[model samples]
Target: MLLPKQMTRVLIVGSRNALKDTIEVLYQLEAAHLIDFSAEEEGFSLGAPLPESSVASQRLLKLRSLEKDMGIDDEDVSGQMETGQIEMDLASTIDGLEAEITGAIESKNKINLRINELEADKAVLQSFQALPLDLELYHDYDSLKVFTGKVRGDPSALVKAAAPQSEVFLSGNGDFAAVFVNTAQADEAQKALVQVGYTEVPAPAGPGSPQKHVAKIDEELEALRSSMKEAVDKLDELKDKHSTFVKAADEHLSIIVEKAETPLRIGTTEYTFAMDAWVPTSEMPKVEKAIAEKLGNRAHLESLEVMSRMEPHGHDEEGEEHAPAKVEEIPVKLENGKTAKKFEFMSGMLSTPKYREIDPTSAMMITLPIFFGLMVGDIGYGIPFMLLGLIGLKKCVSDEWKTISTLLFFGGIWATVFGVFLFGEAYGIHFAEQAHDLSWSSLLGVQLPHELVLGGFEIPLGIYSKLHSVKQILYMSVWIGIAHLFIGFCIGFYNKSIRYGMKHAIIEKISWLMILVGGALLLLFVVDFMILGKDVALTDIRMLVAAVLLVIGIGMAYKGEGSGAILELPGLMGNIISYTRLAAIGMSKAGLALAFNTIAFEVMWGHDFHVLGSNSGDIVMLIAALGIFLVGHLTIFILAIISAGLHSLRLHYVEFFMKFYEGGGVEFKPLKVIRKYTIEKNGVSE
Candidate 1:
């Protein structure tokens, strides 16, 4: 459960004629992680793709183009399609869809282009309407040069000065001007118009009033818009008709293309091919039996080596060595229970664990939520968190949201437990009466029991308050840190022992274990001597043992890890101190909750409102106090999710995992097809 599934390297060799059959068998088994052929092997070359690849690739390209034109999203695929049905209809359906969709798209594009042109013409005609001129009257003059456009101010005076023979018609708005001059003085007249910030609006080529032309354009625009709507509806109808087929066909063709390309990863001669792959050791027997039964004497499976957690090592030699020239990495496939699998994403966010190391997902699953619950220990928030997480788990399909839901569900369980037993609080208020502070019992004017008895056994509801129990909580957090790191070091020791041998593991990991133990002892001594003011001296048994351990551990660490160990002495203490944040965050939340509770209770009590049936306080003041309480607690609830969630994750990643984890391994991915929109009633192609 703590390690990745063991892998065995296998070599499958076969006649070139059986290549396709071999590929199909391996994909069906879904156990092979194929290694790409290097092409350096003597007298061999990479295999060629099968003949069907070209035809399938062409069909897939056309199907994808149709999908794009139809604006098909994954959600648009409504139902599954049988592979046999898809195969029978794919060719004819693709041809029909291409032709029909092409026509509709072209028609729609033409209509849109026409509508844009008509809108532009209408704008120009409207501008000319302001000038009080007919479309033809502004143009088609032999001796006159007409300037018809808008101007910042009136250009009538300036135009008249430039050419006395020119006629300047200024609209009532004085912004639109139409100047007509003889061809000889056109240049001078234009210069005068430019002086007043003139911009020209070309007259449309037509023979009618400006308003009449604009009305005509509007009618044409309405017709084109109707046509566009028809075209869009036609495409939508076709998309609805053929969406399932297109999606299924795409999947089918993609699978074919992938299988065809598998040969490119293997070595081939004129008559024979060789493939290299890794399969889980436990599945080797099944794979071998399948190949022998399916392909007979044409293909042979040979087991090369069963990989071990202990790495292979050898001394340098002049003669031929036992190790291969190249050392291929054995891919890691983590083995975890369903519960632990949810936290795999968190570990993967760091990196996949190497095959030689223990998988950390199980460990993280056990601790991460406990840390979160410790930080956000409140029943008020915990119940709501559990509900939201349960809903998310049922609704969410993505890995990210599922992982978050898992954290919330598990963390909320622990939070509720701690809130009931350890803190005995709900939304920052104690259940029992407080000496000087407000509590549920005090506010309600009822006596709330401090403990509950079941079957003659007493269980204290509230053991300690978050704010008042800071010293103990902080002390407990430190020990939690110690125990967590101790687990990490033990795993590291085992990992190193397997990977490099017991001597190296003892020198590297056991040395740090000593230092951690020594520091824990010294912590106790310091608390007794300094905080409690005890008369303990330097000769105390705990102090002497701690000192000896520190000296020996430091010496061993220096010998194993060199000078870096000496420098890390203070850093170890800092790592332990970092766990105090667990206490600090809870206290901060409690402080906020306390302030809100105080304000709300003060408001209600000041107005003389004690219980629900009280006639002393006004209903308006009660409502106001309730509003403040709700909003304040809501804010704290949201902050709890972010602060508690993130700090808990950080504790695992930065402090705990740093002690043991060195992850960066390739994840095991086998060659197989995932059919979402399609199902095969008949078996896959041979």
Candidate 2:
């Protein structure tokens, strides 16, 4: 739809609390549509009403606010925006829902508090059970005796040793060696026993040393554990009772704390608590309807006012109605009211040809095929290209590249057709066989006219005569170039006609046509023939005259413009010559193919034949030949593709675009809820 090309005002509502949320929702919606939005607060006012400045900006601001207010980490928010569905009015909805969440959080907080208390009590109980033991076992002996594996005899040990045989007594601190044992074996053992002694000396308080305190410590520890466990059990019960409160508190604080700090407000409008956002222009209506349905009377929606390069008051006249400007719409035509459905069909195929305004999609569609055919001009290469392109189309999910894939598919088809033509297959020409068999008669339905030999080798005239000549292919290349250049001129003329008027179109068309025709003829007839010692045919002389006429026409057209036009003739001439590269590349492709085949077969195969015996050498020759053929041809094919694709793109972008395209048009962005992998049914995340 056409609308005035002017800046539109946007109004947002709600306090800072809502502002963050509102801004977030709108930002995501706009981004999904590829719209660039920047925030501007200088002219914004909360009291006075104004139009929404930019839906994209509003959405983005809201997204930022949502991230900050909700305590959502910045990284998390960015990841969400990247992976989540972008939605219109999602910011406001998130804000409102978050507002309600505060209440729920309050209740939850109470429950969490109770649970914390219970955990603390349980920790206390566990601490009591880990008390250290009170009793200590003590013994004293000489260091030398212990190290030497000799036990010092003490009174307690003597009593234990004699208890099994007879009643015996020992003093607590008395040396064992000073006491004599009343035993029959004592006399015999005494002669061999060394004086080693130890003593268990009783304290002044006797056997009551530290025992009462140890018993008391054990009793205290047991009591502490019982008390702590009882307390933990009571705390757990209390937590269960208040669990809901804790959950509510947590939710409440998350939403309300942030909202209280930053108030949200509508921008210079009475439409408080709600705002509009920009989305992809294509999805504008759907988003608007969704917002209306979700918010009912609370939401206000408006159509997008897209910006344009054309000035509204170009020629001011009294009471003149302004031209309605809208976002640049794709140029499409429909048949049978079916809308042509190019959206799906040309998804990947619709490439942004380097310079779109000059050549446009139409020119690219034509030129790309020529380049592809030239590069992949063999049936074998063409088959791979076609298969690869088809596979890409089938497997690729990005809609952005679908159009490009489609173009390649068609390009492959053209390559195959051209390949067949170049090989003379339709005419039954088999140069490959004739190369081996000099006796072969007819080739491509033509009889041998003369003996065709090259480099002192006798070659079959039937196939070699026709195949060796590149003159026909070269001529075709020149003709194709002429047609292509003419087409470019027509496109330029059409563009000028649409923007300016019929007069300008005619003048420009005539001027360009004359320039192209004259330049091409000069190259093909005068320069090519005269400088190369190639005789000009009678028809070529006629063409030279036409070329002169074209030059004169160009001069006449630019006569009134300025002397600068004359000065620019050299540059124009250069551009015309640039078209010649197309033909050059085509010829190069054919030449390279021939050279690769020739050298690979001759050198590699010839060496094998000279060195090895016939039977064994034949196998080696076949393998080497096949290897060289495949590798050499493959390398040539890759180079050709790169050269053709890049050079063709350059021609379109630089040569063609220089004539017309002005590409700084702002893309249309609408506000909408976008989801990845799946569509959102409720228009909101649960």
lDDT of 2 at 683: 43
TM-score per candidate, chains pooled: 0.95, 0.49
Candidate 1 wrongly placed segments (more than 4 Å): 313-326, 607-616, 683-686
True-vs-predicted CA distance for residue 213, candidate 1, Å: 2.3
Give the winner by lDDT: 1
Model 1, position 632: C-alpha lDDT score: 99
Model 2 misplaced stretches (Cα beyond 4 Å): 1-267, 270-359, 396-408, 423-467, 518-564, 603-616, 677-679, 682-686
**Model 1, span 609-646: residue lDDT tens:** 33434444568877888999999999998898899999
Whole-model Cα lDDT of every candidate shown, in order: 0.88, 0.46
Q: Tens digit of lDDT per residue, candidate 2, span 428-478?
A: 223343444222133223463344467997644222122444555455655
